[model samples]
Target: MPRLMAFDYGTKRIGIAVTDPLQIIATGLETVHPKDVIDYVKKYLLAEPVERFVVGEPKQMDGTESQSAQHVRGFVTLLKKNFPAIPVDMADERFTSKMASAAMLAGGLKKSDRKNKALVDTVSAVIILQTYMETRKF
Candidate 1:
């Protein structure tokens, strides 16, 4: 079965997550440099069947689009232009980074480890995917 992929987009890096083939669990896949994300997804597609994409929709506390959202939408446009078959959706991403940090602390990560942006990105992607999944019917 095809799986769903999620991305937490940032200016410098993008965190990725993918569901199991059964679509039962979402797992953190990797953190890729912004420039390398397209190539990375291309390579990943060779091994996994991805049916759809879930991108974090950056929003401010005031319910306005965040400045970074433009960059994310740009990425989504490029993604659609490259892979016209797959559908893309966006999920609210407010507080995901803070949630990731709290999760890391609860997971007993060391102070140094908790400070790793890459790790936070990956965890944030997982949270996004999981939240998206929770809203789905299946």
Candidate 2:
């Protein structure tokens, strides 16, 4: 079965995650620079079948779209234009970074390790994918 892929998009890095073929678990895949993300994804698709994409939708405390959302929208547009078949959905990203940090702490990561922004981004993508999957449970 095709897997579900999720990305935590940032100005510098895009963190990617993928679900198991059974769609039961979400795993961190990679973090790529924004300029290389499309090519990275293209190469990934050549190796694995992805059915849909989940993008983190940045929002403010008042539930309004965050400024960074515009950037995400642009990326989504390019994504659709590049891969017309895969569908893309956005999930609210509030508190994901904090959640990622808390998870890493709970997992016993050292303070220095937990401070790795790239790892945090990847973990945030995993959290996004997991939340999306939970909401869609049958």
Candidate 3:
């Protein structure tokens, strides 16, 4: 079975996570510069069989599309264009960053580590992947 990959796209960096072949567990893969995301995914595809892509969809408190929605939509378009074989899906990501920060605090991470936005992004990607996995009927 092929794995499922998830992305938390941001202006400065993109966080990545992947599910197990059985789609059971979601694990944080890496955080890459926004400009390097395509190359990174290409290299990763050469090594791993990813069947699907999940991207976090940012929305405002009122459940409306946020400013970052356009950026994520563009990123999704690029993914669809580059990896036509893989289907890209979106999941609501209203409080993922806050959740990630809470997780880091609970994990007892150092202050410096907690201050890293990239770390938060990576964790958010993992959360997104896990959320997608749990929602699957099979």
Query: Per-prediction count of colliding residue pairs?
Result: 0, 0, 0
**lDDT: the better of candidates 2 and 3:** 2
By TM-score, the better pick of 2 and 3 is: 2
TM-score quality measure for candidate 1 = 0.97
- For residue 15, model 3's alpha carbon misses the true position, in angstroms, by 0.7
**Which parts of model 2 are misplaced by more than 4 Å?**
none
- Model 2, residue 49: displacement in angstroms? 0.4
lDDT of 1 by residue, 1-138 (tens): 999999999998899999999888999999999999999999999999999999999999998999998899999998999889999999999999999999999999999999999999999999999999999775
Best by TM-score: 2
Q: Tens digits of per-residue lDDT for model 2 on 25-88?
A: 9999999999999999999999999999999999999999999999999999989999999999
Candidates in order have lDDT scores of 0.95, 0.95, 0.93
State every prediction's TM-score relative to the real structure: 0.97, 0.98, 0.97
**Per-residue lDDT of 111 in model 2:** 100
True-structure RMSD, every candidate: 0.8, 0.8, 0.8
